[model samples]
Target: MTSVWDLPDFDDHEVVHFVHDRISGLSAIIALHSTALGPGAGGTRFWHYAHREHAVTDALRLSRGMSYKNAMAGLPMGGGKAVILADENGTKTPEMLAAFGDAIEGLGGRYVTAEDVGITDADMVAVSQRTRYVSGLPVSDASSAGGDPGPFTSHGVYLGVKAAVAEGLKTDSVRDVRIAIQGVGSVGSGLARLLTADGAKLVLADVNNDRAAALAEELGAEHVASDAIMGVDADVFSPNALGAILDEKTIPGLKPKIIAGGANNQLAKAEHAQLLHRQGIVYAPDYVINAGGIISVALEYLAQRDGEPCSREQVMERVGRIPERLKAIWQESAERDMPAANVADAMAQKRIGRA
Candidate 1:
């Protein structure tokens, strides 16, 4: 079955399609964005789903968010997302990836897929056998440049947090800011490193105590239990964990002056942005702030397809623009006295109009 979430003003569609497999009870969710600006390019994620409804919801929301993220980041690519439900830990197995690859191959080029949260470069290599619609995957040693894009994402978020803090705290530097980060995953760990380098005092928490402790030690940060992060007195609250963490229950308990993070879809709903607004927390829209990975991958995909090589320098400069783009959103939100989410939506809509 397919469900469509139409962004009427933007003339784009987040098409949610589901595939329920007989074997493994594997359900695949595909979100197709048809050329809001250009090709609908995104990555494929494979995960173990507790429920089919959850997968569909994630696909639809992620697809729409990607559209906004791409449009706001000034990328020609539109947005799409694919999810393959399998084991609890996401399949690294060739067989599972092959099945997931087949699902993407069916989408044609309207949705150019790439490496996402659960998928890897090697997995992209597996998908490449099925379709040419995949990106963020280097095909060879010369092109052998595809892997974790987490660091760049963290860098962008770091800059984004800096911008949010500067504007929210009325301070030019992020130095001395107390930042409590939930999640010590790839993106979160990288963000912690950057924040530490910027002289911010850190409080770290993650579900995985080993990783949390490792990262805390690396950054010389203090550690806290994951759920206790919201109560931590801090200048910046970064939710680098899963989405929906900023819902009504959590937002009201937030003590940060500025809220920024690498997590996708930090707000559970549009109203949460207003809640953050009411609390005087400068909420950097997740889509706008954490677009660095997609941007880097898409550019590389374009280069490889067009016979041009992707350079690290160009990608870094592009990633660096995240702060500027976010600053634009922040300023617009302030001037309009609206939620940052609205400003982000408006920015995306404007791009679609231009197209």
Candidate 2:
């Protein structure tokens, strides 16, 4: 068990809350990395971890990323994240969600929670019953509501891929470019549809073979085993699943010329960015490209504050800027001879008044 005082480098973080509800078996950590930009806003990720330490690490890393993501996207928000230690059986109940929501409410709006991996719109709805400091709820008549952020997130990533391809491959289009996608969850599936419609040849993989097979058939693309995905000789490799994919074991064999996806913390460590650059691969920082969901939810949060409904078109318009931001980062990377990840971090730090 980790205590807030014992957390590594706690001076750099603004707040960290360890929450537990015995009755509902809710164990969660809420990490607020910063509030310099605004109130901390990020998603609640539900996953089963072998040790509580892993969950704590994930919450810290992801919350800091959220802070950077918000700053880089020019949103008036700070970075925060929540992680729920769940059962492997996927038996999340409404009572557990309510308990988590209560924990979030206790923060007094310093942090806002949304849906992330292993979380859904329904889950957010349940969370909202106990706290207003939640986003990504289905649209309702009572107030401006937010729903699943997957499509918007996917759209942002698709645009980022275009920018990366143009700079990395010197191409204007994804059409006919072989793209390998890992994870066919909501965001990945949405990206597959967009890329296929744009004529990109796809190779897909998912732990859930049925999900992968279904998307492959829908896009008329090839399917590979999840473990074999990193080895595919594709023009671009998009990891839409969990973090730490671009780590030591997988980096050596990763055959893609470009790395751009919706996953947060794609790099196993900061050093992996240099490794990618050394390999002549263009690496789009995951947080920069994946800010679409937060951008949408942030708008929703504003609308709720103003007692108005969120506009999808308005959200998409803001999401469209992701490519422009990525293009600037890629250019800076070239001019400075730095990894794109480093460039992105610099950009974010500058925006957040940390540079």
The regions of model 2 sitting more than 4 angstroms off are 1-11, 140-145
Residues 68-134 of candidate 1 have per-residue lDDT tens digits of 7888888888878888776765545665566666776776667888777766777788877877777
- Residue 250 lDDT (model 1): 83
Residue pairs with colliding backbones in model 2 are none
| lDDT of candidate 2 at residue 48, scale 0 to 100 | 94
Model 1 scores a C-alpha lDDT of 0.78
Q: What is the overall TM-score of model 1 with all chains considered together? A: 0.91
Q: How much is 190 displaced in model 2, in angstroms?
A: 0.4
The Cα local distance difference test for each model comes to 0.78, 0.89
Q: Considering summed lDDT, which 10 consecutive residues are worst modelled in model 2?
A: 137-146
lDDT of candidate 2 over 1-355, digit per residue (tens): 6665576634377888989999998999999999999999999999999988888888998999999999988889999999999887977988899899899999999998899998988889889999999887787543333678878899999999888899889989989999999999989999999999999999999999889998899889999999899999999999999989887778889888899999888998888899898888898899999889999889989788778766788888899999999989888889989999999988888887788
